[model samples]
Target: MTELQLTLEEKIGQMLICGFDGLTPNDHIQQLIEKHHIGGVIYFSRNYANVKQIADLSYELQQMNAASSQVPLFVSIDQEGGMVARIDNDEVTLVPGNMSIGASRDDELAYEAAVICAKELRQMGINVNFAPSLDINNNPKNPVIGVRSYGENADLVSELGIATIEGYQSSDLAATAKHFPGHGDTAVDSHYGLASVPHNQARLMKLELAPFIRAIQAGVDMIMTAHVMFPAFEPEQIPATLSRRVLHDLLRVQLAYEGIIITDCLEMHAISKEFGVAEGAVKAVEGGADIVLVSHTLQEQVAAIEALIGAVRSGRIQEEQIDVSVKRILALKHKRHVGEYEQLTGSVAEQFGTAERKDLIRQLTEKSITLVKDEQQLPLNLSEPTLVIWPEVRHHTQVDEPIVQAYTLGPALAELGANVKEFRIATHPTEEDIQSAIQLAAQYKQVVVVTYNAVSELHEGQVEIVRQIAARNDVALVVASTRNPYDLNQFSEVKTYLCCYENRPMTMSALAKVLTGQLKAQGKLPVTLSPEYSFGMAAQ
Candidate 1:
């Protein structure tokens, strides 16, 4: 009877889904389910070892869910390719990104991209994909959510973002359009710090809200709120994540979004620095969020859930409000066919680097790779050895080492029979290292400095490396800027700049193709980079 003993607090706790870390589901997780009956869990790349491993974990998670018959669990992952993807498709398959798709303006590609993402994730026993970032990256200095967005134009963002959702919906995976009203307009990364966009309701509606509205109309399963302030809308101390006006009135009543209203990670800085994590979860739920997300840090999840239960018991939140979220979670779970999807892995693993995928990747990457400033020194007469200086971004705490197998690209480049010199530039390069790069730049007929925003700090060491090389020689800088073109300002002397939009294999292959003249730079700058690198700055 003690096992069956219940409280409204515990019932409310069951409706709030959260995430866990590591490979195995721990006793802490099991206790949360069997005791408090937490509603859901979000998976990350770290929780996965391979396809088979995830299938087994999904099975176990479901088994735990069965212990309580309130509702099925909400299982999710970040499968958005480009800068913020989780699944490892062996470096063969990928989508170029929302920006690339938007630049192409091909609705067909949008459907194809979404279908591919959905199908692959579905095959691995995944039920949800936090994708189709509905942010409009009009702000050039935004530390996060750059090329992850579709483009700067609101109308285009609306069009392509909706198309992406339809594509995901086609394959029966619950697709989420996230960081509502929008996160792309902010100049800060919410992961490490709080961010705000000083836009009025008029500006937000015209720019940021366009994509989310379009996505909702196209049958999005959920809308994830941003942890950003909307003073003109809320007009006070409330971010969209904890604002009833932003979530219910604007999104639900006005935009007519009938789907689940999920909040972004409760642990993120924008929320956490304000109220502690526990109170933040309650605030998000009270703000018209159907599901409060306590993502990241298992310890925080425990504390937040406890706090939520306490709040509900104390009557700070009504019991019916908790039921409302659980009902939404159940509805999404059933619609997603979480119980019916085949438990097969590696069915399409061989599809990576397939002719079709490669072709699409090549095509999309060529379109996305922006040529902001070039000396017109491209189509380089590289009959001679070009000193290729490669920069390593984060020191490897890599999980995909053995599965990544041997280095694929470096050796493959050798087969192309190009004399490529490699340099490993860490996060911070000393003056001696700068001189070495300078000296090397003098010797080579063309110095190709390959850089990316995804791996390295956009404004840190790479800038120093590029500036030093450009100063010394007529450098043919092949900038592999995966996200922001903001880095271009620091390297004005770069003879040829390429925006590969993503650092994934798709974008990588495109960069290689364009470098070898197998392809041409066709992408317009999707966002403004000042008057110098404005939208459509590249050659027509």
Candidate 2:
């Protein structure tokens, strides 16, 4: 151990990982490693340029730490495909979300997805995969967990979670089952601010905790604490990150999870709004969080170490506690054998994201298309100019876009026929836009309303518009439920509702094949919608 390692302050440094701003920030990160001895780094889109660049970066980062001390650093990232990937986007194959995979209901496919995810991550020197989102999306109004979750059902989620975990670890990457004690029922996002849950032990044990329990039973190597506050469980002042009741009493003791427990980012609004990163880091370790995440503070990374060191010396915190986390972390590193990347074996990228597994996404999209409520004209008159209502893919400037290819919906639609004219309906349809679609319906023999929800937002008016147009005598509705499938109430009139679950490359192709009569739609809805439709309802 280096001089820094001699102090509890320095070991705590190994607990607070951070994200940086380039593919080649390895040298600056190395300087920090030598200075503070941080536990690890959480990679985002910014730190990566391509596969080769990231692999080289990971090598240099590991080399610097080896030069300083033999204590291994946790190299981690969110490789949860669909929308959650953070490496070299263009260089990496963009996989669909968990719900899409769950829609297929194929365990092998889920396993393969993880295998590919792990292969790429492993090739680039990532040892910890902060993924296999075990959240049971029991709430339809849940904004963040909609597409990210496997489905609404607990058993389904547990099954897929196990498969995903297995896939990730198959290549020797440490799999972390996240947002512990269930982030499923909460309505708000922990990213923007704190979210609360008020359920008791009975309800939590029955529903919300199912996937988490199952995931833990499935051999999850790590568990990440949710930033959300569940006041009912422990009414005092602790969020899950700071709550010893949840982390120690429940997850550690009750669930019997002996591995490391990593807290979600301490820099998130939930943690930052109250405690500084240093204070949060100190409390989190006391709360039994083996690894406290400070993903955005490279400069302030040393502060947490300094605080913990002071606290340990003052008897406010103990050195043994720090050693506990350090031991668990070292075990994780040893399991990874951090310096032995070259010796790590099993599946590689070629085994992952194959043409066959890629085909499953298309197959699931076609199967998951839920035809909610449709008028008598089942297959449509087939002569109308189909109105394609696509919610604009809003561009967020805060996070860098992965170099992955720009996504589009044209080629799939074009396969059906050249005559299928497409119109861009604002996802949240406007009254005037409805009138425009209505007017176009008059000129065309059939009016097909194709709809898509961009993110968690419910394009409220579009469904009402579909309901109105579908009531027409000559018109037929073809509602394509793209993205999150929750907004099914928007199209009561459409004869066919398709839950494509996502807008990935294969999903579009599957939809195109189904619409053009190349393949019959076979997917059933994976989760329960409103009172309007039952769960697993798929069209013929």
lDDT at residue 331 of model 1 (Cα atoms) = 67
Which residues of candidate 1, in runs, are more than 4 Å off? 1-14, 89-92, 345-359, 395-415, 427-432, 454-458, 473-478
lDDT tens per residue, model 1, 125-214: 677788878898887777678778888888878887887788888898888998898998787777666677788888888888877877
Q: What is the C-alpha lDDT profile of model 2 across 1-540, one tens digit per residue?
A: 432355654676777677776778655576668887787888887777666667777877877777776777778998777656675244465566778777777777678767867776787788898988888787787766777788888888889899999888878899999888888788877766778888888888887788888877877889999987777677876689988888898888998888889988887777788777788878888888888787766655667667778888889887777787777777777777766764223443453345665565445345544455544445533354555544443444222132223343445565556356655565555678777766766665555455555223446656666676767766555666666786665444355666777656666667666665667666656778776676676644
Give per-residue lDDT, candidate 2, residue 1: 41
Output the number of the lDDT-best candidate.
Answer: 2
Residue pairs clashing, model 1: 92-353, 369-499, 370-499
lDDT agreement of model 2 with the native: 0.71
- Residue 291, candidate 1: how far off, in angstroms? 0.8
Count of clashes, each model: 3, 14
Model 1 RMSD in Å is 3.8
Please give the CA lDDT of all the candidate structures: 0.70, 0.71
Q: After superposition, how far is residue 50 of candidate 1 from its true place, in Å?
A: 1.3
